[model samples]
Target: MSCQHEESMHLESISQSSTDHSLVVPQCPDDLFVVSQAVKRVKEFYAKHGEIKESHGWNHIQAVCDHTRKALLALDYTIQDNVVVEIQLAALLHDLDDKKYFPNTPPGEYPNASAILKEFGISPEGSRKNSYEKIILMISWVGCSENGNTVPKQVKDTDAYHLLIPRWADRLEAVGSRGVVRCYQYNQEKGLPISSPASPRPQNEEELWAKYATSDKLQEYMDRGGTSKDMISHYYDKLLHIARPPKDIVRNSYLEHQAESSSKDLVEVCLRYGKSGQVDKEYIMSLS
Candidate 1:
């Protein structure tokens, strides 16, 4: 199928899945207002750049919004009106820099995208002003590591977690699994080691074993007919790998034991706190 056709089909599938799962909430009055204003701002920004393709343009925003809404609902979290609006705005305009400023090249080679958002009047001073900045940061986070300081760990976790679900479900089926296997085969053919085991090492042996042990636990979850929630939980844990150190320090202090006694289970310990701790402690603290 053509790229346009594939994009349309993907959007249709997302819409149908979202509806079937009762994922799309009717917009509250406040949410509607924010969405409308954001939509107008996004439209105007894109218009100045010339004709924008829907698949590569607005529909991408729709997909992200749909996935994000479903994720929030699944977590039994209240979807605040402004939060949804901000997330939508971020999703919509995240790629604007790629489309306009970079065009043929990648956005990372240029200045930060948040600066461009500010230039486009998307970052007008108010509570909503920071929304644009947040979105720009998320875009950069996914695109490149350099200018991703503004991308909160929460936003990154939200985006990555949502993107992984459909794939997880799809890959659960035989055909999809075969497709993934085939892709791996192709990668191997192209000189990638698609299934190589890690070389044995003595350094950090305990930490390495702890990592494998957690992987075993996740595999056990999958073996026992794991639901999407289980998978999401696992993915969330994986994302929190960096947050474990401070938590370990604190937990060790609490136990009146040296940090050395704490099992060097980096992934599990890190995942226990997840992205929230990573953001507040690692990201924001670094900024200060």
Candidate 2:
């Protein structure tokens, strides 16, 4: 969502419960305060056990927040009673109980994350609980079943897709700059190779195909040689699939950034490490 950034919200006071390790917002939160404090609490909350994965750690949350702001700014939205705030709030806590980071929490249960929300009086019967849980469930990976949202009760004209605004915002991070960072980080954490002569820079489209590309799905692509366990392979299989902006407005902005007479060089921009981070350029494709 190549949108202008949204204004920042502030959280004045937040503390963790020592007796129970649950977070407590210092104030009787207004919508802005609840959302802002939730965002502030994510890092500490997840880091409490010291097992947060670097790939999806607090920093990833910040990136998604930035992406969320951009998405909101790009939308031709008409708000109905702080729905935007609720979307962002749900986005803020999207990964609170992610299986990758909080394996013990498991699906079908809120566990510790629910306790944090409870301290600020966010629960099933709380004022914002229904909306909060709704948005969170919608954005979560497990929220969908059979390619449709688990909550399939469509609403008025635009609200039917209202939840998708935040959903798209959150996924933006999975494809672009943040995606590359995460790919490399995950490879490092899992001890996967970044690149080698065997998996050198892809010289053709077929070579760049994901290692998981089946012979049937992408026959020609599968014909190209590759090792399935490398970092580049992992990206080609998953992250690159999300490189293009999913929304029309955001896609328009993304196209504007594409190089003249080029296929956007999306991967190159990421592998370039646009923000001065690590990069691997073994692929021979020329990127402007």
Candidate 3:
């Protein structure tokens, strides 16, 4: 089936089912084939590398792929089928070489993702005219100290518009209540506290990375059982700022507005709990 969600759900519901079962690949044959292959590869990768944290685990990949598929459907007239394939593949494999997991891999190298895509006939070289690597480089919003948290220079013109779908879709997953839960989960895994009354909000992405990133820093947080980095601080530094002003790549006022509203809800909950260690009943009722 061309439906990413149906294929994903089947994969989940079955016991190691083959990608061919009930699959009806058609039209964009390479897209269907590559996506199916990508799904299988990601499942295997996460099964091995996913220590225990679900923060950037398989579920996150599924959500991002779903978001990308939906977002692209709205711009179907402008995007090509191959571009759709590239974007979805980027979303599915975005975290494979995450600095959090594969700390030794250099930024933008994407060894893990590169290998998987090569197997699927997608080479990882911008000079090769392969848009796969460009999409991969464009979708990452973290772990590149040189690039900060923005689109890279490699993505230009229409490719910029096409590549941005996965990036923003991934960002959408990191906003609102889901983002709060993920932050708490990651903190618990790293032995960081849910909240620290003493630490200040991070001044920039550099400070954020310096404090709570990399395998070495993860070990330090585990050993110390804490740091200035905490779940609340993470919200202030990153999660709270999920929505940004529209850029040239793409603009969806509805999505931006929804992200802002959801972020506000998360911020209110964070503020209430950070202050009193309990949710305000009045606010909870208002959400209902």
lDDT tens per residue, model 3, 1-288: 555544444434442443332222222545677678778888888888757368889877776676665565445344445665666777777778777667688755888888888786667444434676555665564332232234555555435555666667777767655655665567667876766664333444455435523334333433453333556655544554444424444454434544555665555655576557653446644553
Model 2 regions more than 4 Å off: 1-29, 141-159, 193-201, 205-228, 245-266, 269-288
The TM-scores of all predictions, comma-separated, are 0.36, 0.63, 0.70
Q: Is candidate 2 or candidate 3 better by TM-score?
A: 3
Off by over 4 Å in 1: 1-27, 40-55, 99-124, 144-288
Candidate 1 lDDT over 23-102, as tens digits, reads 23335545455555555655566666554443234444444444444433343233344454445545544556653335
Clashing pairs in 1: none
Work out candidate 1's RMSD over C-alphas. 16.9
> What's model 1's lDDT at 223?
53
> Which prediction has more favorable lDDT, 1 or 3?
3
Best first by TM-score, ranked:
3, 2, 1
Candidate 3: segments with Cα more than 4 A from true spot: 1-27, 125-129, 141-159, 199-228, 244-250, 277-288
The lDDT leader among the candidates is: 3
